[model samples]
Target: MAQKTVLFKHLEQPEIHRLDVYRDAGGYGALRTAVNDLAPAEVTQMVKDSGLRGRGGAGFPTGMKWSFLPKEYDTSYLVCNADESEPGAFKDRELMERNPHQLIEGCLLAAYAIRARHAFIYVRGEYLAIKELLDAAIEQARQAGLVGERIFGKDWGCEVSVYRGAGAYICGEESAMLDSLEGFRGFPRLRPPFPAVRGLYGKPTVVNNVETLANVPHIVANGAEWFKSTGTEKSPGTKICSISGPVNRPGNYELEMGTPFRYLLEDCAGGMAGGKSLKAYIPGGASAPMLPGDCQDVGIDFESYPAAGSTMGSASFILFPEDCCIVFAQLRISEFFSHESCGKCTPCREGSRWLRQMVERIEEGGGREEDLPILLDVTDNMVGKCFCALGDFATSNIVASIRHFRHEYEQHIRERRCPFRPHPAAEPLLQIAGVA
Candidate 1:
């Protein structure tokens, strides 16, 4: 574990969230350097040179995203996506709650680099506590002249605002988040006129995830080469892997990119819980296809998992025990996507419903042999057919479940019940003495 701590090192220090404590610890020095010495282009180029990618699942290049703004734009915005709504992903929330100024300073550095005066942190409404923590951090920064006007007594200044959204899973999508921030219903907007070109009040905007922005200050303070020295060439710096499910030490572990999943499972998480052997695991969140547990040697980076036919999205690993029912597990996922569908696209709105119904029926022992192909066909139609990835996300579980655990599904149908999971106890029966 040669991974040097970029985000987690100082988290335990008391009052680390305070602007004063953070500044004394040499925080915001990157923002100061950018404001005092570096030009906007230089800062942007530095991030570009560092090879920072979005940590919010997509793995898109951060520098290129900032560079997308037109050369001359009067108005632009920088949105820090703090809506950590994905199940098994709580990295952003933890970052903001513990070391808030780091995220704030990162946002300001990015705002300066992009030449955007206004930055907004669109946090999930459920994270009211985190929102307030950020709010206080912003005010503290403002009072100290780090935000508001003339940051660091320089001509350039960036103001950061914390905006909360109704808890919509769809809002985690950048476009939908834009719509929600703009006071519209949280629905995903169509692309082609991508947010970088025309976004947030019809102006150029750059939306970076909480963890992505939090990395900015570190990259600025430490040279790109220094940052690059930690992780793989493509994925530089450590990644906070949010480990969940039945692991003995189920929590967040910051590991260098390219660290094998086996290390995380055995060394960090202390292996599976209750002495249960691994059955299957979601390499990413629910949106990623589940990989059989035997693939533990797969590296936790942008490339490795996909090479193994699964995504390393957000690195939200959810493991399953051998005794777990694959059919029932997928049923819950289907139900969630069905309920959270934004209803913006027909394939997603309708396809998700159909998948959930069929999966529910199959899990409940009402499925026919023919239902499997029908389910696959439904997911086939749903994948990449929706306005957003939500539609495509809904398909990963079912498709991967059958691909890897088809035997389990077959058992469910053959036995007319979930073999791994115990069924409800039979109703108690009593007979009257006279009747007997």
Candidate 2:
């Protein structure tokens, strides 16, 4: 199957966002089944048996994560990480916009599984309209006795709240989102007293990505084995792969986990756009390392990516064409990491800025043969040194671009200008003159 539209199947329906249409199409059946029939422990076991991993960067087992909660908890939270702030990751925003009910139902089922009394969909503030849609859907679920007051006449009663964040990339981190949900500055908390033990409002919590939670309803409605039959054994369930940049059809496509990137680019994405040959592609989001054009057969799974020296972070694949400058692309990405840096850790705060400056210098024809080792050294200092993954993320494209396209950077330095762009950046050229 080229594109398996599980969550996206009903997106074409104009009114599918509405509860009535959603229910008519068998929506909330999972939540109903989960609440009325399965016990919380049973629901958790089913998820564990399904082998569903987080669709976000971490790829942790969803069921095992749910099982982390304290045995006896008075109150807990379930957070849906809808802050789709990664550069190439736009699947979550559309997933919430088009299929709000399914998301709501999934949240409800997750809440039931974890015994969370409250579930919050922490959305990106840029998505004002989608936030309204989720708010309305939550209200709809509430009115139907699906959200509150002994859901399905059982002892479990959970409600969902839509909390819009100010579009901080750091807030996409679970702990940072929890801090934001508690009305604090969006900074990640120190671990050990992890979220499952003391999370939102200082209670146990489970944070999952929009795509990860969206799959829960299907898993619960159909058995775990049914869900497992579709994707790879290691990475069970489908992934909503977001392919952007220079592709004919650069949009989200729900695909089997182990499908190769070649199929996605040639068939699903309608091949490269404007007759440009594929020079490279970042298999995951900007955080994932960019792969060479020749490595197109890389499978889109948790194991396949790491085996190929990259990752499936958010399953956001950003394609690059021959005409595109790898250094320039990495410069733009580094600048983003620098701009979005929360400054909580010195490594990321200083290293990201320095990394951006180095890449910018290389692109503007000020790079040295020695700058290569210096750039690598700087990234070496920053990796695994940040408060969160931001610093580590800042180095992915830079290191990968250097590794795969060292000749390109060398060409820029040797020719004293970017090969792709004939006209050179003038400011750096002017700096040599000292003619202020």
Candidate 3:
């Protein structure tokens, strides 16, 4: 595996986040080098060359996103979508809290590359303290002429402002973020005018994920080839793998993309909590479909993950031990998606609730074999019938589960009982369990 880039670099340093400490550790030096030496186009080209995609859920290419901007437009903007509300995804939060300047530096470099005169970091409301830290970092950068006015004594100049979102998951979508930033409602707009050409304030804009922007400084500091040396040939660079659920050491593991799941679980995260045998895994957060234990050997990269039948969405690796009930865990995840759905689309808004209800019924030993087809029918109705990706995302687990674990679902329906009922956490529900 290639070097762990952002997370491991200044991790051990007690004062790594401090302005003086970060500066000494070759932190914002990349920004200085970028502004002084590289042209904006060259920087964008370099990022493209490096094969950096959006660290956000959607794996859109970063430079391609920047290149989508209309060249003749006068007032293009860049906004870092820090409104990370994905279930089981917390990499952005760690980056914001522990390494604000790294993100800030990336934002500045992206702003310069896009020729954005103004930029905004749209942070979620829950990250209040992190926002303050980022603001302070921005101020520090501004005072040093890294932000605001003619930065680094160059003809090009830009300013960055941090805006807080009103705790909406939908705002994580780029267009919705732009809307929220403009002090409007947070519903997703129709996307023919994708954020690249027509974005914030009806001008060209580029919105990037927090972790995606955080990669910029290092990519610029080291050449694109250096960044490409790590990870898979297609998906380069180290990604922060958030390994949670039943793992003994459930935390972020920033490793190269093609790192083995066993290495990530055993060596990096100290294996499962009780040395239990591994069950299924939701490779990239709850949104991505579950992978059976047999596929554990698959490399954790864009190409490999999809080849194993899942997308690399935000690198939120959630593992389940062999003893854990897939039905219960899936039901819980469905409930979460049902709760978080923005209700913009009918399929997601209503279908998620229905799906959760069915799962709940099955979990409580109150389902029938007939319900299996019904569940599939319900899931079938949701596919490609929602407003945003969130709708489809909400249904991915149920679809994948039935495809792989139909017997488990059938066991719930056939005997009106969960085959693996050793959990004992369902006493309350079983007390009132009845089939509908």
Q: State the C-alpha lDDT per candidate.
A: 0.86, 0.86, 0.82
Q: Candidate 3, residues 370-413: lDDT per residue as tens digits?
A: 87788778888888887577788878999888888888888887
Off by over 4 Å in 2: 422-436
Q: Can you write out model 2's per-residue Cα lDDT over 1-436, one digit (the tens) per residue? A: 4568788988678789888999998898888887778899999999999999998888999999999998998998899999988878889988988899888888888888888888999998898999988888888888988887798888879878899999788999889999999999999788879999999999999999999898988899889999999878899878899888767887889888888889999999999877878888887787899999989888888999999999999988887777777787777788788988888899999999999898889899998898899999999999998768888999988889999999999998898788888423222211221100
How do the candidates rank by TM-score, highest first?
1, 2, 3
**Worst ten in a row by lDDT for model 1:** 427-436
Where does candidate 3 stray beyond 4 Å?
Answer: 419-436
Looking at model 1, residue 272 earns an lDDT score of 81
TM-score of each: 0.95, 0.95, 0.93
User: What would you estimate as the lDDT of candidate 3?
Assistant: 0.82
